[model samples]
Target: MAPMGIRLSPVGVAVFCLLGVGIIYHLYAGVISSRIAALRRRRTVDLRELLALSVEAAVLGGREVKRAREENPLEKSNGKTKGGASEKIALGDQSSHRKMYHLIKNTFPFLQVNAEERAPAGGEEAGVWNHVIPADLQLVGEGREVSADDITVWIDPLDAAQEYTKNLQKYVTTMVCVAVSGVPVIGVIHKPFTEYTAWALVGSGSNLQPRAPRGGRSLRVIVSRSHAGKATRFIQTAFGNETVVHTAGGAGYKVLALLDPPDEQYEQADVYLHITYIKKRDVCAGNAILKALGGHMTTLKGEEIDYRAAEANHGGVLASVGRDHRALLAKLQSADSHRQS
Candidate 1:
């Protein structure tokens, strides 16, 4: 041992060991960082596929009618019926929600918790995304950084539960949307009955099949089937009697109708209008698809919906298929002004 050349001292051996450890740690960190970047790049596609699966699960679960009462329940003025026969109905909304949530969790355990759950119940914790960068990532246009905290997933397990219950299969849709820093980047709209799936990434065009031509005779408008209130009627009146109005359920359905209408009898909507407040889950997916098609969705005030806000949208929404947006906005403004005067 004493004859060995260049025998290192104790201090030198410790320094060499430290350097080796440092090198190993650095290499490990680099590998991890690279993996994260790759995952982020493919996140949009992954999410879209996952959403399609989840939507399918929701549709399957929603179709089950356990009891006749679940399909149609007799309404009573009070808890007790005149004949003293009480009935309980199984609501499709809750079952659809559970099915969709569990399907997604079983598929992608990483996105376990719902981002909308501000106060999660016992055993429910926030989703953990290890790949999410600690620092901001570029989203939307330039000069914007989407914080990791801003990333979230919005799901509408059953977009048109009312229609689903009524067996209006065409009106029902399962929607999933991904928002990076509150800006929707990926969206999936799946109709179980028709087996139609429409999806879109922020920069990429929509994957809507059977694309239809836009040229038509009249300015066709699509409005909410269930919640057609005064505001919606006012919008129709403002558009004038010449405009053709179609009633449909589900925000995704309305938007999809604009893209791929059923037949010549049903003309594609030029504008999808909602003149009342709606949850982000209702419109997030539709908005993303519309945007991918070179369309715009904004509030009556011409402001974009802030998905990051606790209340998804404060006012009405106007979604147009590229044309007539500015003209429609001007008419809406004029209508408001006339009403005020």
Candidate 2:
């Protein structure tokens, strides 16, 4: 009936129309899926970049603090300096922390950066991250939903304040760490003087930069540069005189030395031991990086340090390259027990 023997019945026309609709539907669905994937990738990148920026900001701000302290030396009494510019030195400890905090907030307005505030928790006033981190935020390594309450951000704008004021610039470090569900997942440490940065994202492994080989002839140990308290002495005694002890500053720097040691006398430290109490801000970033390198950082009893708490770590922290963590922890625990008795 059609021209040149070409003809279409009612059923044939219906089939053709259905095929067209199906093709269109599939194309539309594919476009939406692609867009969603792109958005997720963008978010992950944004979070990583934000963490890096926070560390960088802290480093830059630390320089300002160092200059202020140098310009106005600490007085013999009251620990205050006398000068118009020295006013910053009075607030040196908090200045860097505040600067990094504000920088993150201004740079990324979409992220609800919580202000550090005192709130009532467990029958006590506790400093907590006030904002709720969105659950949809993707954690780099762990494939799990992270609720707002389960995520916390820690910032140490300037570590080794005492060493920094004393012109021991090598020990100073600026660090930022992000923990989800009480586990550190992202960490960044920046040395302002060296301009060297060590960062780690859980499940992504350690930094790929060229680093000196770890392990040496002796059991290399890195202790606190400034605070050599009873804990340090006990660890030294526990390891016996054969161990090589290298004193350095900054918890982050100590961890870095373990990860990327120098080519000098002390190439690397096998263990980073801190016997005294330390704050979450002080060790969170370093511990995260260490864990990424297949290392372990825990208490003398071999328990993981909890980051969700409001208080500091009073028990002690032992970080090792995973070779002899059990033995080292046991030795330290035995020594601690002896001391207690």
Candidate 3:
């Protein structure tokens, strides 16, 4: 009405422009968020599928191992003695584990077993056509293989073969560790004989957390429910006299058995203990998940264990559960010295 023309106030113009930009940004953010959520969902689905396939293959492999055991028992009972005599055995039971590894490789041609083809980062490539790089969960999907940058998968076939050969109920076969870098974000342990598994994942949040498997409970160490050694006795003394114990074989099996209870026993019995002192392959994925969920794995010297280093296999691991576990570990160290002396 001022001059029969569209004259707008400065404030009005500023408000309108601001609203327009805000609206545009809001729409863009919504789109981006939707995409991110969709990608996450897809990834979850893919992970579930891959896990299912792995479990299935491992089960089949277990059957094969059982069959082999039945056909040719690893050890035979000595007629002269009531106890069975130890017999020479192969380094590895190569039947089920090796067969499955190659089978998975053959079936999924795109997936790189332990290494993949990649160009060198800086140097000029000459001797090799492609540089091999370690990948996390490189799976062959249909015609293409998906290479995830965030996730990693490590497989240790035949974790407790000695126990398996001995036909110990506690023996575990494959140990799978999922990690981001050297930190294990998830852990899976499968026992061939029982056809059971235990798994853990790093939960969501700013702190590293425990991701329990279906009907799974948090892990607790159980050192030789029956036989107690000097090292184990030292640990028990620190834990307390009433502390419960479970029988398990090998570090890998010991760790897994902590998560899984025998059918005759209770699922999870609450105690003051938490898992620490796990080996490289033993706690690789478990430690990753724990750290991601705000936990830490270190050595008896209170130094962080570097998974990439060869020293990870040397054992003598010390891990803490929550911040208070550090105190317990210190006491255990004292006990260790006492036992050593």
Could you tally the backbone clashes for each prediction? Answer: 0, 0, 12
For model 1 the TM-score comes to 0.64
The most accurate candidate by TM-score is: 2
Q: Could you tell which candidate, 1 or 2, scores higher by TM-score?
A: 2
Stretches of model 1 off by over 4 angstroms after superposition:
1-90, 105-148, 209-216, 227-232, 261-267
Tens digit of per-residue lDDT, candidate 2, span 9-87: 9999999999999987675554344344534542332445444554456566566556566666662223421111111
TM-score of each: 0.64, 0.67, 0.54
Model 1 lowest lDDT segment of ten = 133-142
Candidate 3 lDDT, 240-312, residue by residue in tens: 6555544454444544332333422322322122233333655564454345445455565555655543323
Q: List the residue pairs that clash in candidate 2.
A: none
Candidate 1 lDDT over 1-341, as tens digits, reads 56768879999999999999998766556444544564565333244343344345434434532222256543222243221223222254445555555544444444423532321222322222233311212222232233335456677766665555556667767777767667776677777666566776666445553344466566778888655565466775677767777888778888887777443234367788887667777888888778777778888878887665564575778888747688888988888777778
What's the true lDDT of residue 54 in model 3? 47
Tell me the alpha-carbon RMSD of every candidate: 13.7, 16.9, 21.0
| Candidate 2 overall lDDT versus native | 0.63
